[model samples]
Target: MTAPDWAESALALLVHRAGGTAAQVGSRFPLYADPDDGRWTTTGRGSWTGGFWAGLLWLRARHRAGLGAADLLAASACTARLAPWARADTATRGLILWYGTALAVADPGADALRARAARAALDAWDPRLGLVPWGAALGGERLRARADGVPGLVPLLTSAGPTGARAAGAHLRRHLELCLPGAGGRPRPSWRYDTTAARWAEDTEPGPGWTRGEAWLLLAVADALLRVGTLEGSPTRPPNDLAEAAEQLLESGEFLTGPLVPPADTRRPAGPPDTSAAAIAAVALRKLALVPAAPWAAACATRSDTVLRHLADTRLTRPTHPAGGRPGGMLLDGCYDPAGHTAPSHELIWGDFFLALALAALRGDVDLTRV
Candidate 1:
């Protein structure tokens, strides 16, 4: 069978495994739960809350399965209003807008939902610094300095439109000025914000060397470029900064080649090579391939193919360590520590969901080109 067929089957399985309903997944699980204070918290699972990414992934899966826009809107409304952890955080807002916009594009009725999401995104903004605060709880942290720059940017670009996109672009440009390494001409792999120092870190610190930091940036740049391309009238040019960043990520395969290395400060590795990161990279690489003679386009194409193949061939969706294994599949590798105090080491549904969407996009593109 072709890749698309395999992807379809995998998606179906995932939806089924996750209970396959339009309703949002509850925020409470073995490793993830809501704090008594209503804050979403993770134990050992990193970035696996039932917020925007997962909701968007579900919509994509349902769309591929022949679900209509109305169905998607219904599902999205459930996601937006029902998900217990759907607070005003970066991930939640990003997913809300991204998925909500997608729903709007499919069903005009979802314009309200889209508007709500956009408003939420806009409200999260900090006018003084002109950047969206990472979250209300984090005291208005910016994406560039928090977690990894890329993860924050991914949802931002995916959700924003002409006005919102431009605003996001401005904020990102400022972020690059402060956090980016080297001259402003090219993109670098890592960004730093010192929680201790309460400012952008002066040096490139991969922090115990989490591989996803680089991968997240690569995905974010690609996503930003794609959004910029959708603007009206004027021809869209791939941002030179993002193009350069893509090249750096592909070249830094040393970290991507194997399991994540444990930070020097810690004993265990973070987990695996973030299957979701690889999936996001694959889609981003495909988008990069659209640029004419762009130096990184070919490399991005090659990486996309390789990453997609690896995901299909390897049991990456399963657990990596003995401790992670259970009746259900083990969490894939490459996740940060969930406890926010230690390294992450469990299988997360969000990664699997996004990986499926990436595969679907790749397969869809290949099919479109073949015709």
Candidate 2:
């Protein structure tokens, strides 16, 4: 499919792949599929990426057919599995509830789920550190903060409605405040806020500014700013540092682009740039563009478009993925731990799901307020 036909073709393929996968394993949480063999694995609902497969189903069901009793059953099963996660065993409840359950199911009981999610987010907030602590109610050192955690928590709090939203926004603001100091110009990855020792240690892997972690930070902060504005019905002034931080990360995001923009030798590995991060930034930048407070809106949107086009091109997108897996199904070269080879050179469910999300965002079908 050409630029004009990309979304349609993408949607059609997703419907087919997801439908086929559903037929193969209904209501199973598909975490990742081997790009080489198309072998799928089922993870528990509480897994960090468990929501994404269901999320893919929900995204496609919006635009196509083949959804009936099976869709409802799948949705109900997902909700049932995720229901206990309201208090959230992990900080990824935002990922689960927003993607896995929010759009897919609408039973009246779902309201309780939303409330549970909101409470979980609130509970994760650490008053002293001013950011949500990572992990559950464990004792000892007791202060861990990850850039990725911000994304999964902010949406739940911002969407909490009249009760805790402003405070939730305040809590999100704290996360923005506590981001690790930048190296060259870009932000670093994570933080170990040792409330026990009252010291802060840079928590980036192999040093500062891990690729995917930085992208998560960029998108998470931008999303938080935009989300708070819509929730409180108040105008949000762009936090200059947060906005600039996003711009810097977007520059680093050039690493994801295939040598298009200048400064050619990014000096990283020279294959497919992390499409997972690129897809995420694409959708995130487009969403940021919609926010009046956001800066560099036009440039970010254009970059988003460029990433989408690159990802959609056959060289990157394994369009014929679901049927015959030949090491290039959907988006390829995903980096679970780029430095550590834990998840590399495969099509991650999150990567594929966000690629669909980026396409949907381009088509104006995504509701950032709801999603």
TM-score of 2: 0.84
- The most accurate candidate by TM-score is 2
Candidate 2: list runs displaced more than 4 Å: 1-3, 65-69, 136-142, 183-185, 204-207, 230-233, 236-241, 252-272, 293-295, 315-329
Lowest lDDT sum, 10 consecutive residues, model 2, at 258-267
* Candidate 2 clashes between residue pairs 3 or more apart in a chain or in different chains: none
TM-score of each: 0.67, 0.84
Residue 171 CA displacement from its true place in model 2, Å: 3.8
List lDDT for all candidates, in order.
0.46, 0.62
